[model samples]
Target: MNKENIFSMASESVINSDDKLALEALEMAKSKNIDLMELLSGGFSAGIREMGEKYASGEVFVPELLMAARIMKIITAEIEELMETSDMPKKAKLVIGTVKGDVHDIGKGIVCSIVKSNGIEVYDLGREVPPQTFIDKAEEVGADFIGSSALLTTTMVNQKEIERLLVEQGLKDKYKTLVGGAPATKRWAEKIGAYAYCEDASDTVETILKWVNEREALKEMV
Candidate 1:
């Protein structure tokens, strides 16, 4: 199959929540010697992006998004594991988790998978994560970005605390912060001193890629 054809099929697989089609694309990529990077950039990304768009438009609910995430996880993991053994360095490093007081895992899991598929190394800290835990894990994993999710208005406050703790530790410049969840917005991110605000898993991946790619370009220049 052609690249665009596979891309469309892969995307439709996620939209339709078809795990078999998703896996088929993975096998086709390997069989045809098509680069996994190309497959992810085209196929995997297209799928997750559609899910994000639907969620943003209120055309789909959290359950639908979670289902798509579950389907995409397989392909992303396959590509991520394949790339790890190669000479390609990870596009970026991320430490991700749900903020304290927010026990939801669906959104956080989706974002983590999307980011990982895009070639970023993600260390997911799981749900109900403390603000301090984000900072600590980032340090341990040498993460370039810290992402925290909050599903409630009250829990969202912890995202700010993460930024505050980063400043207190004199590490604000060392790591960029990203906050997301249903209630999060660009204004909130700005007020909280975050580097970016992501509306969904796809947005999170896009923003992280922008920064990671820029950093890579700068390093290449030097």
Candidate 2:
């Protein structure tokens, strides 16, 4: 199969939650010398992302979404060994989590997968993470970026607390802060003094890649 076809099949496998097709797509990708990470981000991850949207719109139920997530985890595990052997240098480190008071995590999990596939080292702190925990994890990992997700308006206020803590600790300028979730907006990010507002998993990857590239260019110039 051609690369596009392989990618499409991979995506469909996740969307349909078909393990057989997913494994076939993985084999095809290997035969075609396709980059597994690219297939994961462009194909499998894309499928899960669509599944997320379906869940959000109530077009699909929790079981279907969970099944798709299961398929994603399977495919991710299959390729993880290969991905780890890659010689590519890590571009940056990111600490990510769902803010405290929000137990929703499927969306944030997708963001972590996409971002990590793009060469960023991701430290996933899981759901119901306190703002102080976010800062602590970022500092522990010496992360370049800190990302928080809030699925509820009440929980999104915790994102602001993350920003406040950064400033209060005099670490505001030390790391880039990114905010996202269903209730998070550009205005909210601005009001919280966050560096960027991500609309989705893909946007989060793109924004972080842009920042990594800019930082690399600056280092080269210096």
Candidate 3:
């Protein structure tokens, strides 16, 4: 099928909350030799963004949002497998987590989906991740960025702790760190020495892309 048609099918599946139909779109993309990234950007990512906006506007509820996210996860896993066998340029690598003391994961999961849709490689540490785990994973993977999400005031402090440990390990300059979630603010991020603060998932993608591009430019200059 054509690109427009494929995107329409995928989006309809999302709007109707049909996981099976979403998987069908994924299979169709594979069979049509569509670019996996294009499929993700146009189909799954666009669908999820629309869903999120609807959720925000109260046109849809939490259950519907979660269902769309679940479908996107399935599509993403398939695309990730395809990426493994294809000769695609690797984008920035990121280590992401919901900080310690926070069991909330929906925000982090949404951010992860959007980031991965943009073609970045993500190492998700899941929820309730300790500060040292963030440092260790970022260091171990030589991550280009470390992203922390916390839904509560208590857990948000863990973002600052992560930065402190990075400095203590003498790795503060080795990676850029970004923070987000309901309680995160630009002022808070600045106070904690985070490279950037994103107020939402869309902002998170833009911020990381800018940071990645600037880093590449500096490397070129050197």
TM-score of each: 0.64, 0.75, 0.65
The parts of candidate 3 lying over 4 Å away from their true place are 1-87
Clashes of 3: 0
Q: Which candidate's lDDT is highest? A: 2
Q: How accurate locally is residue 178 in candidate 2, as Cα lDDT from 0 to 100?
A: 93
Q: Write the per-residue lDDT of candidate 2 for residues 18-77, one digit (tens) a residue.
A: 999999999999988997767887888789878879888999998998899888888877
Q: Any runs in candidate 1 off by more than 4 Å, and if so which?
A: 1-88
lDDT of 3 by residue, 7-43 (tens): 8888878777788888888888888888766667677
Going through the candidates in the order shown, the clash numbers are 0, 0, 0
Q: Model 2 — which ten-residue stretch has the worst lDDT?
A: 80-89
Higher-scoring candidate on TM-score, 1 or 2? 2
Q: How many clashes show up in model 1?
A: 0
True lDDT of residue 202, candidate 3: 70
